[model samples]
Target: MTQNRRWRRVLIALFVVVIAFTGYHAVRTVSDAIYWNAHRDEPIERWMTIGYVAHSYHVPPHVLHQALNLPPMPDRRPLGRIARESGRSMNQIEAKLKYAIVHARPPYPAPGPPPRPFMPSPSSSSPAK
Candidate 1:
């Protein structure tokens, strides 16, 4: 009977720990969502990576890379690093990224077949003969 009581206590403790852990993550997720939503339209910064900028501004990373003349890939390097490597000023890189974001076009899905025009049947159009 003591062993059974001890096992119940252990299970209760385990359950409490799990609940606390999940609650912490849930709170963190909500806070992050709020922060990102608030800053979604913030201007680009030199310290930000291309991926971050793309995510914040809803622009494609490939478009930003093309604007900067970088090869197409998942480049995680920060804008400051890219500027240093390319021998360009941070301002120049920022300008290019901003331009790309402004001019970036949303990718459209492939075209589907055109809808057929509606036509009434001859009998209906002419009414009862």
Candidate 2:
């Protein structure tokens, strides 16, 4: 009986570990899918809008997307109206065409090294590194 209990405990621990791993990778996998989509056949205007909105709000790209309400507005709708409705700032509005909303995939970084893996070391990140 003790042996059975021990094995069961181990099995439970293993299952929990697997679940944690899946949760972590699932986030990365979904993000990577978006990153790839942005790079694949996406127009220059769409890419520029993300950078413009993100910088204007002083927020990360993901937050900017969330702020704008993802999946984008219909092409026919004006960006200015959407921005005003969403309570976004003028700089962000200027970043996008007069009033156009694009799809939600994150923008691809211009010619540069691929996104570096997250490092726990503070010095390894930022200019301080």
Candidate 3:
């Protein structure tokens, strides 16, 4: 009887430990997700960083990634390698790129269609010159 009780106690302890672990992980995941959603910014930061490097070097993504020191940000695939190789920091590259694009956008074209005065057609009532 004692042995059976001890085994049962061990099983219960193991079950409790597993339940506790599972609950902890579940709570952690939920909290992390909530935080991420709350703080997430819409614009993708990694691409912006990589794009900055590309603009600076006048090269493709592979070449840029072949050049800076950027963290492993998702969507920065080929460019990350270039940036790390080139020793250019991702933050600096991103800043420069953002500034350039924002400043470079052309102003809206003149509001309305071109102004053309109406002229009577020669085909209707007017005689051909």
- Sequence-dependent TM-score of model 1: 0.77
Listed in order, each prediction's TM-score against the native is: 0.77, 0.29, 0.40
Residue 103 accuracy (lDDT) in model 3: 46
Off by over 4 Å in 2: 40-129
Candidates 1 and 2 compared: the better one by TM-score is 1
> What tens-digit string does per-residue lDDT give for candidate 3 at 21-128?
999999999998887565322343544455544444344444333333334342445434444665766566555544544445455678898889988777787766
Candidate 2 residue lDDT tens string, 7-122: 99999999999999999999999998887556643332322465454444344555444555555432333445556676876566554432333334445668988899976887
For model 3, the stretches where C-alpha displacement exceeds 4 angstroms are 42-92, 96-129
Best by lDDT: 1
Query: Candidate 3, 39: how far from true, in Å?
Result: 3.0
Question: In order, how many clashes per candidate?
Answer: 0, 1, 12
For model 1, state the Cα shift of residue 88 in Å: 0.6
Evaluated at residue 3, the lDDT of candidate 3 is 100
The superposed Cα distance between candidate 2 and the true structure at residue 15, in angstroms, equals 0.9
> Ranking by TM-score, best first?
1, 3, 2
**Overall local distance difference test of candidate 1:** 0.89
Q: Could you tell me which residue pairs clash in candidate 1? A: none
Native RMSD of candidate 3 (Å): 14.9
